[model samples]
Target: MQDILIVDGYNVIGAWTELKKLQKNDFELARDFLINKLSEYQAVTGWRVILIFDAYLISGKETKTKKSKIEVIYTKKSEKADQKIEGLIKKLQNVKTRIHVATSDMAEQWAVFSQGALRKPSRELIEEIGQIEKEIKRSTANTHRSSSMTKIQLDDATREKLEQMRRGF
Candidate 1:
């Protein structure tokens, strides 16, 4: 079965420490950070990620775009992120897909749970992200180690001696 993850953007940003701190200085930065994290999560988990942001107060039409291979949606004016999420839960429901909604909102959790989608609280998602980061670090370290082992590290004197030997000196 294919997995789909729906993220409540503001709720997650408000829940995560780093994102919250970034939001204090620049909201856009926080949003971009969250999107990049989600993109990474999607890449690692092989899940389809949909990140939804509320634009009710900004007075903009609904917008959908792809960032870093993840789908990002901004709610239309007067539309709440919860409402958009609920609608998506309804539309994306199917036997072949298992949907997971990530947010800290208790009410939204209940709503999505009733729709047969699993609820992952913000902190839980953060923990998973941390684990993913650790795995990535471990993988990178292994790759670096393997690549480094392949290179010959001879000092200049040793290299010169080898060259002389090869030339039948």
Candidate 2:
């Protein structure tokens, strides 16, 4: 079965306290942070994720997407991100596919639910992501060490060269 995670980009930024502060000063930074976190999550988990942003205010009305195996959408001038996500649910929803929408907006949650998709509040998503991050950190803790530190393993060639040099010295 296909699993999809549809996120309201701005709504999440507004909901997450850290991102909320970033959003006030630099909206792009908030968006980037969300994408970076989600990108890591996607790499760790095998869910198809799409983040929708409202670019309705931009006069040129651009629709750009990024492929970290995740989609980033900037909605058209005539439509809202919520509308786009609802439409996406209609297109992707099926008995075999599960769609999960993430947003703190109550009306939007109900809207996606009507289309047979589960809704996740931003706070809940944030908490979940935090847990996942901790897990990743714990798992990767010993994977890398400072370059100047002790060598856990050395190449055979380097070991042989060092042995020869030591004998000559």
Candidate 3:
């Protein structure tokens, strides 16, 4: 079974210095940036990523949507992100699923840990993301280098035939 990663959206944004600054200027951009980065992480890790945002400022029902193949959820006005994450952990917990919640809130971390779900502090999660990004970069560089280093040697006859095909036929 695939592991699940539950991210506290606002909590992470507030905890990350760059994201916090970006949020001050344009809140939507910060949210979008977080979503995009998480989507990339999800693609690389092959884990089920669910990002939960609190709707404390807006009056509406909770909403769930998929953006870039990642699940994004906004809690109802009465519900907070932590509550939504906790509830999801409970529901998704099973022998086949390993649930991990990412949040900087101490109380929330303790609660999740007590519930048998692993907790990742905001900083640690951010570092893990950085590592993933670095690994992707390294692998891409290696691929380019290896492809350039290794050449497919074609004999004169084969090369002439391929060139003739390209010309016509």
Best candidate according to lDDT:
1
TM-score per prediction, in order, is 0.89, 0.82, 0.88
lDDT by residue for model 1 over 87-123, one digit each (tens)?
A: 9989998989999999999999999999899999999
Residue pairs with clashing backbones, model 2: none
Candidate 2 local lDDT, 42-99, one digit each (tens): 8777888999998866855648788566799998788898999998999998888999
Model 2 regions more than 4 Å off? 144-169
lDDT of 3 by residue, 33-60 (tens): 9999898889898999999999988999
The CA-based lDDT of model 1 is what? Answer: 0.94
Lowest lDDT 10-residue stretch of candidate 1: 53-62
Q: Over the full model, what C-alpha lDDT does candidate 3 score relative to the true structure?
A: 0.93
Clashes of 3: 0
Models, CA RMSD each: 2.6, 4.4, 3.0
Of candidates 3 and 1, the better by TM-score? 1
Highest TM-score, which number?
Answer: 1
